[model samples]
Target: MVDEMQGERLLATTEAVRLIPMRHSEARSGRRASGDFVPFPVDTTMALAALTRQFADSGKPVEVTFRKLVHWIRSGERSSHYLHPYPGKLLPHIAHFFLANGTYARPDDTVLDPFSGSGTVALETVLSGRTALYAEANPLGRLLTAVKTHPIDTAGVAVALEQVRGSFAKSRARKPPEVVNIQKWYSPAVIAQLVRLRAAIDALDAGHQRDLMLATFSAVARKSSNADPRFSVPVRYRPGDAPARPAPMELFVSHLSANCARLATLGLIDGLGEAIGAGNDARSLKAADGSRLADGSVGMIISSPPYAGAQKYVRASSLSLGWLGLTPASQLRGLEERTIGREHFAKASWGKQHPSGIACADALIAEIAKENPSRATIVAVYLSEMRSALTEAVRVLRPGGHLVLVIGDNTVCGRRFASSEYLREMLEQLGMTVVLSLVDTILTRQLMTRRASTAGIIATESVIVFRKD
Candidate 1:
């Protein structure tokens, strides 16, 4: 081993800051709830620091036994991951950790993510020389994920950018689609730019290039809209607080330039490993079936299922969806109602429904039903849906394949719901055994203090592993 001075060079250098909420941040602008990374709980950070250096210096595929993906609990994403802004996205560092530790997966095996939000897992898998498959329910999410993960040459993206500019200059723009309460979300001028951008993207033939432009358009639309896209749907702004719209072509080109430069680093996955994906529900991955994975073909599954009340994911993307004509505001209500974890139960019922075999969840829900029956119904709806999701995860995984679920625990009327425990019980009923578990300290600023529990807010997330055999 090197002496003290030389050893310092081997460790990853990290900047530490207080985890408290502060001014001059995304939280301050009300544009985001979670702030930048801050080292926290001292011990976890120090332990993770040591493990990260070991993994980094190894330079070979890592074994899961010694992996500490929780290190990324404070590590925000960088590189191609910056192409799109998605709330609650799984960090690329975490995906890289899990894939490296995939001892069950052989060199030629495939990795799958049923809820591949923004394609972090798929991108990491393909880049690491393993094939991957993705199924994301939100169409906008699928578009962003595919564009972020796919690798197109700089020359092709440049040509597509020029074509978009030419289309805008030729005066061939389409009319902006109308929706109910449109003015409340976007100003008339912003709508005009969205329509123009949409027309330009449509000018290109359907391909990755077109999709990438649409993804760029999605980002531009969010910036140009009147809605406060901080946490969830339009956090109604004060009359004078409406955001100013930038010149469409200039804004789009600038975003394209920055993203293209970042993507040059991600490039495309090398070797024969490819990412095959489509917009489809994770509850039913019918879109992912192919000659490669026809019979329980996926060797590994890593995902972060939608957490309860995290955010109305579809509503957050309404700005992106509106520009694409994927869903109108009037119709978006119905669309969100049909998706899991996005539903709002009208006039509660403590209907006594529970996720089958999850006694801990049922018990917690029952306790909440005693205080406020309505909240209990919400609890039941979320966990029952998680059961269906986990069942689907089990179906696609090979008999010996592994499934790693990243989730957080939360509360209902001060009664704690240990999501990891409930999920473990559910996995056991599905013929899987719990293999490993870790509770990573949450380094994010606590945004939902209103939901704080008498047991104190859940300040950690459980990373649970299950193996089907």
Candidate 2:
């Protein structure tokens, strides 16, 4: 039998192991050698024990009884630990623990994600048997979320594909603009066939249309682009790298059919909630000021905000966004504002000056000096938006509700902005108590290395859990 002191030590040791960059096998081996660590049969139990200890150490009061800890550990042990196969998609394994631990639950709860990129949280919430509300400012993002969550009828989708094929055969007489584009990416004959197919899909009734079309469109957007095959984001086109573009019609049909098959396999056709695609600003949130939702209304909040200075989402999705009738020109000027990075600021400065000219140089230098002059301005904007979002979340949540926010840090001009820390401060200022700050290895890695280095960032991110008092 383990005594209390030994148990605490074991929990601490296990948590330390979790923080180490080792595989599960390595952790097990190390634990065995350490002799002070308990051999918990399940990985999640070990993880939970670490998290519980972390919460206690953070000076946040937790009233979880000993029985609850045991139950939580047991529950985690039974839960699946497999990673979702989708690379760009959110990790289901991480989400499951949050859900099971009641991190997003209330007496009566509705989940909301303001920056709901790719709709992972929203979809997961719905799949986990809860209602979710998702709002995204980007149209492409909104469309992707809408398509993923919308239900489909496999049988109807198959019939639609067949019809599209037949229509493509008949429409060979008349060509669509997409056909010309497809010809650049695919063989001429393949392009011709695709054009016909797209026309058929376009002819279909709007009410019965499935997300298969959008998925197909997205698929071809990659295959038929003039951009580098290796690069996911669309960059300036280079010579000889351009593949034969597929005809718009053919590409659309292919995209539709392929996605239909994938959706059918996933068996996610029914019971999906409403997912709207609108050009709303995150700062404004399309809500009246001072509107507070009923307390304890929301169950969870999960999202990945824009990286400090990485991908230009609007430009990257220009082709797809255009196809979906969401042109960047239509979005707000601020929405199109580039992620402020060190380089961007430098470029703005360079644009304003001439070499060796006093006034010209001074004016150019002035613009450069003004670069990121408003760190507080950006923070204020983000905080104001978040406050509105939180107020709504708090109103909707029942007493003792939880909100889980995952945000990475940003670095500008060599200064690190601890975004999560700022968020913690802001939430506390708004009367919420910090609950758990469990750091995931993958997120930590990306913030500290990948995103930071690629975009010249100098900061790291922290995952924060907050509860409304």
Candidate 3:
């Protein structure tokens, strides 16, 4: 939580630099530039302006080749991307690079993101003046994407926010939703504040405005909890050992105000193509109307798929899930199992080994199973699921459209798991021709600097571009 005095200083400093042009990394890192320190705050228009500065440079001479593209783009995010906090989001520049480049996809063309984690690709697509189509397995991610891409009525949201603020004291505390080990995650005072805030938010008419408030509430739900802030996954601190934090309602109001400003800035963009959310599963992508996606319908597809047993997206979202009343604690495992790269499996399914059909992948699985059979099964399942997802991606992409995948390698059972290689082989078998493959050094990521014993630091990521034959 931001301290009150510090928050005031931040607000003042943000207002001062609102007109200055700053680099993406410089603004984010709070580096001293031209003898003035610019720190990243929750201010909305400044962030929007900083991101737009990158787009303004589109007129400069540039080539589309990988070597030229690498230097042409930089990591930055639009204001809407800050509407919610999501783990392992693809850097906005990567998606912007593909969408803005006329060779891969042009304005008004439709782009699809099957994984759509937090709608990074979708937001970028819309900003590039292309229609954005996406499907996300996690309900929280889907909701976030929906809110991020849509334009918000700032005046209406502000009135509603004030009403919510006034009603908090009078709002009755509703019974908390069923969350596993709830006591370990939140204190009584925090829970009371959250439930009351939930009640107030529920009173509003159901629409985009309500969704904006809900997204803000969800962010507060995570920030005000006992979970350790350093780690992506929830790690509860011992009772009374947790540090002091801001009140839940205070956090909600501050975040909602900032988010509203962000949405207003997003609304300034003209001719932003619509962002549509397809159904949950990537293996069988569909349209928002529940219609099947026709073959060769999408002009391009871009995604950074979940790695094999490396991320715990479901677990990371469990807190928000319960607070939003989307899923109860008991059903989290079921939700986890449904995702592509889950580590857990039923005992019956574990007994049988499934081959990914790639000789090298199967060989690696066999080598892993010699020591930990269950871990090996996780790897096999990950590969199998990705194959299905990729098949669907290829099925919907236009013949000449490109499929750009940003993936990285990780360790499984203490051995190197070449996931990027496996994906390339799988795409090839599906008849997709590899066009360009570039490896990027990861500067910072959601995962710990040193990951758990089984997984090591993912130092680099491979960006592979493929075209359907």
Candidate 4:
């Protein structure tokens, strides 16, 4: 009877031990001596402990709550308004979160965005009164960043515009080669006017004056293209015998004027940081990897990397790339050859070729095991490149610096792809801790296809944060 009572007491004690929520420190210190170990934070510990108990009682693991985790990742207070002029490129509310949360605030801090698409983050960094180093592989994206971040003397811009108008009035010539292809997408008169404008801009002497002129010219490129601003594909004017679209030179002028007006509204002309847009690949950034930058050099890193096999950047920016003297064919072929995807992973010794190649192959193989091989290679390659970038970021960042990655999950061949999770894992492996993962409420209509819209649904994007540990 005494032995039986002692055994029952021991069993009861074991059950009670399993029922209690383990403290975070216990888990972190690895002091638990039982099979019922749970990771930190009282809430997480209690929830997980209860889950394990229920699972053990049922003889099965409880169903995973991936949706709940995603919800938790995205939950945050939204911002009310944007401080910059081009709020459309970046959701103002999201940008405000970084500012309010002290993600990009430092008196002597600089920010580096390896994949600075459209200059949203860079502009925000400058608006927050910090220096930003913006780089992009796509010429058009680089140009956009350069133009948006370039400082403008409001008075000087006005005088330059007046001079350009004077030059246009004096010259009466046919559209140049650069503006000729643009003609098919615009009205003849508009094309002629744009040609003259380009000439006038080209004639300007070197300085910020020239940059301002180029900025105006670039702002008109979208209007000069076919309507709808199809970012992923070519600007198709006629669809199988449709009449040629008319150019809206006046509309383009108005757009330029509005941009100038918006600049005036923001009063950003007084103090803007240097915005260099020279074409450089994010994978092989100009800076040396793992080299130490000045302490507290960079405050924040905000960027959106390329989605695997989703956007053929060089092809999408063909017109601009052509003008910038980067051959589209070479770049497209190179990107295709080097990008990660399912097919590349099947080939053995993929990583032996290039550092990115190995990562792409590994990612591809991992996804293939789960039967999602379509773009896994590219996603993997991006992860590898991002790892290199993160190393650079760490080298350049000050202590307690922040890095924000605006990313979206993708689906390939009807299978869900969790690129963000992979990125988080990679960053953590590099000794960075995830600070927060906020879901951005802004919805983008681009990149939605009928396949992705099956059952009329699409996956949302999230803004993930990481701090160097």
lDDT of each: 0.65, 0.47, 0.76, 0.50
Give the Å shift of residue 136 in candidate 2.
0.8
lDDT-superior candidate, 3 or 4: 3
Listing every candidate in turn, what is its Cα RMSD in Å to the true structure after a full C-alpha superposition?
A: 11.7, 14.2, 7.9, 19.4
Off by over 4 Å in 4: 1-89, 170-193, 230-232, 235-249, 266-279, 284-296, 323-376, 447-458
Per-residue alpha-carbon lDDT of candidate 1 for residues 30-78, written as tens digits (9 for 90 to 100): 1121324221111233343454455457633233322244443334444
Assess the local accuracy of residue 267 in candidate 2 as a C-alpha lDDT between 0 and 100. 39
Residue ranges of candidate 1 with Cα displaced over 4 Å: 1-77, 172-174, 178-180, 229-232, 236-245, 287-295, 348-355, 445-458
What lDDT tens digits, residue by residue, belong to model 4 across residues 158-254? 5665566567667665644442245455556655666676666666677765664565565465446653364444556556633444343343344
Best by TM-score: 3
**Could you tell which candidate, 2 or 3, scores higher by TM-score?**
3
Q: Which candidate is the best by lDDT?
A: 3
Which order, best to worst by TM-score? 3, 1, 4, 2
What total of clashing residue pairs does each candidate reach?
0, 32, 0, 9
Better of 2 and 3 by lDDT: 3
Model 2 Cα RMSD, 1 decimal: 14.2
Q: Model 3, range 1-469, lDDT digits (tens) per residue?
A: 4444443333232212122355655332212223232222112334333333543465221222332333333234354787888878787757765654446775557999999989989987776657899999999999999999997876677668767766777987769988767788888989988999998898888999999999999999998988976677888876677888789877876787667656654555555568898789999898878999889999999999998888888988889999998889989998988899888887677638668899988998898878777888899989989999999999999988899999989888778899989999999999998766656666556843344566677777787778887
